[model samples]
Structure formats: structure tokens, C-alpha cells
Target: MRAVPTLAGGFPDISEMTVARQVHWQRWLAAAAILVVLAAIGRAFVNGQIEWTYVSRFLTAKVILEGITNTMVMAVLAMALGIVLGVVVAIMRLSSNPVLTSVAAGYTWLFRGTPLILQLLLWFNLALVFPTIGIPGLWSVRAVDVMTPFLSALLGLGINQGAYTSEVMRAGMLSVDVGQYEAAQAIGMGRLRALRRIILPQAMRVVIPPLGNEFIGMVKATSLASVIQYPELLHNAENIYYANSRVIELLIVAGSWYLLVVSILTPLQMLLERRFARGALQITR
Candidate 1:
């Protein structure tokens, strides 16, 4: 402690106190234990049966690159489709009409209740139910030809994503004050126009975080399409391993790519959140 004299000679001296830093022994012990465990795991993997050469050699293979490209393409397209569907379904769910609400509810229930892999399989084998699908007279095509692995994966992943995304959208819209709706109506704006011009913009800030996370999930979900023969990263990795019998190495390569993608996307998501949160009192940084 240090005493400082006040400007007024008659005033008592003020004592300056120093804060003592706390040493958390428990925290140090926990960190040391975790480091030890991680070191052990790393050593095991380094000495394990996985061939590092195979991982390095195939990481940038043409097929692997193509597969990652396809994965990103599918993720973007599917998320776009999901967002469109989710917005529409959320509007329908919030509608006053019983029929629209019921239909939207059923759509969400049906898609969300079922397993995504089953949906992919069903879409892939649509020919079993409908041999041909097209306009009655203007056009026609075999279902088998139309429902390729790409289309199957798209429909399966997009529709499932929509089911979950609808809830996120609905929550965001609900987060807005009801007074905002009344205020918009007072300005002679129709319900849809009010939503477009006022509500949705404000809701976007609240929704962006969840939506970004969902997109990351969608990127990983592309792997599920592998079961339906979609040539995504995991599928291509599987093919390489199947041929070379280097399963762990190929999986590690694929995982590293996935991690790289997710890492890149994380910063992008933060940027998007900040963009949407502009003008708000507390913006996401």
C-alpha cells in the first residue's frame, strides 16, 4: 500500500491498495490433466496404423478436390432452397387461415419426423412408386432418369433443413415486438408488405446466428448423401480407401478438409452476424 498526500495539507493521506492476483490451483491441475490426455491421444495417432504419406498424397487428389467442390455446391444450393422454403412455411405457420397453418404443420412434421437417409433413399428410388413423372401431355420422363443422386440429395437435405429452419425463422419473427406490426398497419401497409419492409429486416439480426450455424450443419450433412451415391467429400474418401485399403488415412484427410471448411466458415458467419446487427445497440463482434 502507498499513501498519497492530498492537495489540502489538512486532509488525511489516501492509501492506494494493490490487488493480489489469485492462483487457482484447481484450474491449473485441470489444465495440466487435459494437456496430458491430449498429448497421449496425439502420440497414439502419430504411432497408430494410419499412414501419414497416404493422407498427404491423397489430400489434394483430383477426386478429393472434386468431391469437396461438390460438397460446397450442394451445401450452398440446399441451404438456399431451405431458406426459401422455411420463409414460406414460417409465413404459412403464422397465418390466420386454419388450412394454411395445418398444411404447413403437416409438412414440417412429416419431414422432421423421418430420418434424412430414408428420405434420400426414397427420392433415389422414386421410380419404384412413380415410374414416370412430368407434365401429362406437354412433357414426360422416366422417374429413374430424373431422380439422380444429385437431385435426391438436394431434395432430401433441403426439405429436411427447411423443417428445422422454419422454427428458427418463426422464432426470429416472434422475437419482434407486436407493436411493430401494429405500427406498420397504422402506416397503411399490408401484412405482407409490413413483413417485408419492417419485420423481416429486424428479425434477420436475431436469425443470422442460428441460420449461420444451420449452414455449417448443412455442410457436414452433405456426407449423409454418401449413402445414396452422392460423390461428396466423404464418398470420394470412401472410394479411395476402398481401393487402397487406407481407410483411416483417407478419413483423416476428409476430416481435415471438413475442419478447414468449418474454420473458414466460422469467421464468415461472424462477419454476416455483424452485418445484420448494424445499427443495433449491441452488435455481434
Candidate 2:
């Protein structure tokens, strides 16, 4: 019998034509199935009972535009609040003090454990529990008056976001080498200064990608504000459809606007990631 050819490394040379040729039949089957599914979906969308005209007509309507504005505003404000709280919580979590750590942990646990919609409802209806809210011996406001739909949605979403953001920030902070922290301290840098100047810049490389995802998710999560009658995109779309009975079309409009926002954000995220990554790489080198 002929000896199979061997390479310089004493391995069988598959190029010598002794290896069996295998067909990737499963891959081909999967491709075919995917094509069939796509075709079915395309046909349904083209011939379905949905009125495509309304989608186009209401896509840029004034009401929709206003809703988009509200969504953007809400997302921006909520994310800002969340980030501030997240930084505070993350620092507390990493602190040597047990009280600070425990408080941070408990805050994260309570918020992250609850459903977001329930939180919105609770904030909106807080007047039922506390009729007035303010610092003692200071000016007070009625809870119902202060906790309007907008304020309620902001607190609910922002506070809930802070819980998850704290975890992400903590992970990023922990990714930095202990040596880096020690080196910063050796240079007479205080903990807060080291974090602000040296640590956070490096940690941002790790933190930014997930934070971008959270921002995108927050855009979608704003739809939940509708339950509290916040006039965001989804809520406004509901009002439009309620009057005109163009439910699917109105929803399509909202979805399209959301896609547009995400598309815009995607490039900005990539830019921010690249900027932070360059700084990190320089430090490593």
C-alpha cells in the first residue's frame, strides 16, 4: 500500500488528495430554510391587511415629531441622572467603609429586583403613601403635584438605570490593574483624584460600549413611560391611532423613528469607543 504523504512537521498532508471531501449539507439546508422564511415574511408584508399608506403619511406628522423630541429629551436627561448616580454608587461599592458598601448594594438590589413598569406606577401614585414631600422645616410640595407623569417617569427610569449602571461601572473600575492604582497612590494621588484623573479614563475604555448599549436600550425603554401617560413617541403614537384607528401604521412610525435614533447613535458610539480605546492603548504601551 502507498504511504500517505507527510509534511515537514510529521503531519499528514491533506493536499495529497487522501483526505475525504465532506459536504456541508446542514449549512446548505439552513440557508435554504432561511431563504424560505424571508420570502414568506416579505410576501406577508407586501400583501398584508396593514395600510402601508398610513405609515408613510404619518411618518413625519407634527404629533410624531413632538413625540420624538420628548423621547430624546427624556432619554438624555434620564441617562445623565443615571450616570451621576452610577458613579457615586460604584465608588461607594469599592469603598473600605461597610456602611457605604452596604447602602450601595441595597440600593442596587432593590431597584434591579423590581419591574420598571411597577416602579413608574409607584412613583406616579406616591401621593397615596406620602401626601407631601420635602425636607423637614423647609418648603414642601404635594406629592401628586410634584410627581406628574414626566417627573414620575424620569425618577423611575433614571433610578432604575442607575442600578444597572453601577454594576457596569464597578466592573469597568475593577478591570484596572491593582498596580495602576498603587502607582497612582505612590504619586501622592488621593483616591478621588486618582479615580477622576487616572482610573476613570482607562476604565472608560471598558465602560463605554455597555453604556452605549444602555443608552440605546433606554430609547426603547422610554416606551414604558406611555403607561404613565408621558407624551413620548409610543404614547403619542397611541393617541394618534386611538383617534384614527391606524394602530399598525402608527406603530410603524414609532418603530421607524426609534430605528433612526439608534442609527444616529450607533456611529457616535463607535466614535466614542475609538477615542477611549486610543487612550487606553497609549497607556498600556
Candidate 3:
């Protein structure tokens, strides 16, 4: 290719047609690859091996419905606990007190370092190490009795979620300008009051988006509870497939429900992010 003169004499001129042609080829390659993959997937779905009829029949099965309800309940309760613990730990991590900061750091380190499945198993099998449980003389119970599948799942998922949530909460809080805190303090506001009234509202704009993603992730993560024999959606689906010997169909049923839930949640998350972003946009403008 011959170099052409440019407006700037020091620089070589590039051919617009050449660049456009390259881009055109790249786009076509990508489009073709996508189409091929889609076609393969379509062929697989249409293949007689997958038993689509069974998938449809069990899509609205009673047990699957119950499983979905349980999964939602687990996600909500776990996320609620996570949010509460996250807020507390985030505040503690931000505290000036060394002890509180250390404790918060330790908690995050411990939970985030471990695999979630390990945590669930540990909680489920805690009875092996601690045979009895109680609050002194006030109450007493066996460890196994206390650590039901539901409770084990909650503790495992919720506590693990808290470690991640705390980091997110802390990042959001830190995103607020330092002067905002000083300004709040200047107006005769206590730290807690300032945080509640002046800081959190702004922080929520940053927090809501990631928190929404985490909530969506939690919905999928609930399937881990199945390892502990918790009868959430995937667990129930597994039970049905085991009984019916129609494994792939039941998987499709479970997957369909997950897609449905996520599709519903994505818009809600966007709405919340937008709602919390009101003041931020104005301030930036």
C-alpha cells in the first residue's frame, strides 16, 4: 500500500476504505460465528434426545412450584441477613477503633476466603464438632436439632454473603466525598445521624446497582443449599428427575424458572438504581 500525504505532514495518511473494509470483515466473522453457535444450540434443542415434552409437562409441576417458592424465600432471608451484617461490618471496618476494625477485617477475611460450599457443609455438619448447643441455663438444644437444612443454608449463605456485601457497602460509603462528612459534622450533626441522613442516601446510588447484582447471584447461589439436602428449587427438581429418570427435562424446568426470576429482577434493579441516582445526576450536572 502506498502512503498518502496527511494534513499533518509528519504523519502518514491512512486509507479510510482500508479501515472500513477490515472492520467489515471482522463484523461479518463475528456475525457468522454467532449464527453458527445459535444454529448448533437450536439443533440440540430440537433433537429427540432431550424430551421437550417432559420439560413442558413438568414446567408447572407442583413440586417445582414449591421449590421455586423455597428458593425465593431462601434468597430473600439470606440477603436480608447479609445486608444487616454488611452494614454493621462496613461501619465497623470504617471505625477508628482498632479492635472493631480488626474484628470486621477478620470476619470478611474468614468468610470471603472460604468457598461457599465448604461453609454450607461446615454449618450442616457442625453437630459433629459441637454436640450440644444452648444459651447457658436459659435454653438448651442439640446441635443437630438446631442446624436444620434451612438454618444451615441460611447461616452459610447469609454469612458468606455478608462478607462480600460489607465490601460493597464500604466502597459505596467511601465513594461519598470526604467533605460531605465534614460538612455534616460542621452542622452540629453526630456521626451516626450524619451517616443516616446525609451520607447513606448518596451512597445508595452507588450501592444499589452492585447490590442488585449480588441479589441476583444469591438466587443462583441458593442451589448450593441442595448439597445440604435443602429442598429449594434445584433440589426439588433433582428429586423429581431422580424419581422420573428424566434428568435433562427437569434441568430445563429448573433453568426456565431461574430465567423467569432473573428476567423479572433485572428491571426492578434498573428502576431502583435510577431512583437512587436522582440527586447524583443533578449534583454532577
Compare the candidates by TM-score and give the number of the best one.
2
**TM-score quality measure for candidate 1:** 0.91
User: What residue runs in model 2 are displaced by over 4 Å at the alpha carbon?
Assistant: 1-21, 279-285
Q: Candidate 2 — which pairs collide?
A: none
What is the lDDT of every predicted structure here?
Answer: 0.95, 0.95, 0.94
Task: Give the per-residue lDDT digits (tens) of candidate 1, residues 1-285.
Answer: 456566576775545545689999999999999999999999999999878999899999999999999999999999999999999999999999999999999999999999999999999999999999988989899999999999999999999999999999999999999999999999899999999999999999999999999999999999999999999999999999899999999999999999999999999999999899888887344
- Model 1 sits at a Cα RMSD from the real structure of 3.6
User: How do the predictions measure up, each by TM-score?
Assistant: 0.91, 0.92, 0.90
Candidate 2 lDDT, tens digit per residue, 139-217?
A: 8989989999999999999999999999999999999999989999999999999999988888999999999999999
Instruction: Candidate 3: list runs displaced more than 4 Å.
Output: 1-23, 282-285
How far out, in Å, is residue 128 in model 3? 1.3
RMSD of each: 3.6, 2.8, 3.7
**Candidates arranged by lDDT, highest first:** 1, 2, 3
Per-residue lDDT value at 217 in model 3: 100
Against the true structure, candidate 3 reaches a TM-score of 0.90
Give Cα distance to truth, residue 169, candidate 3, Å.
0.6
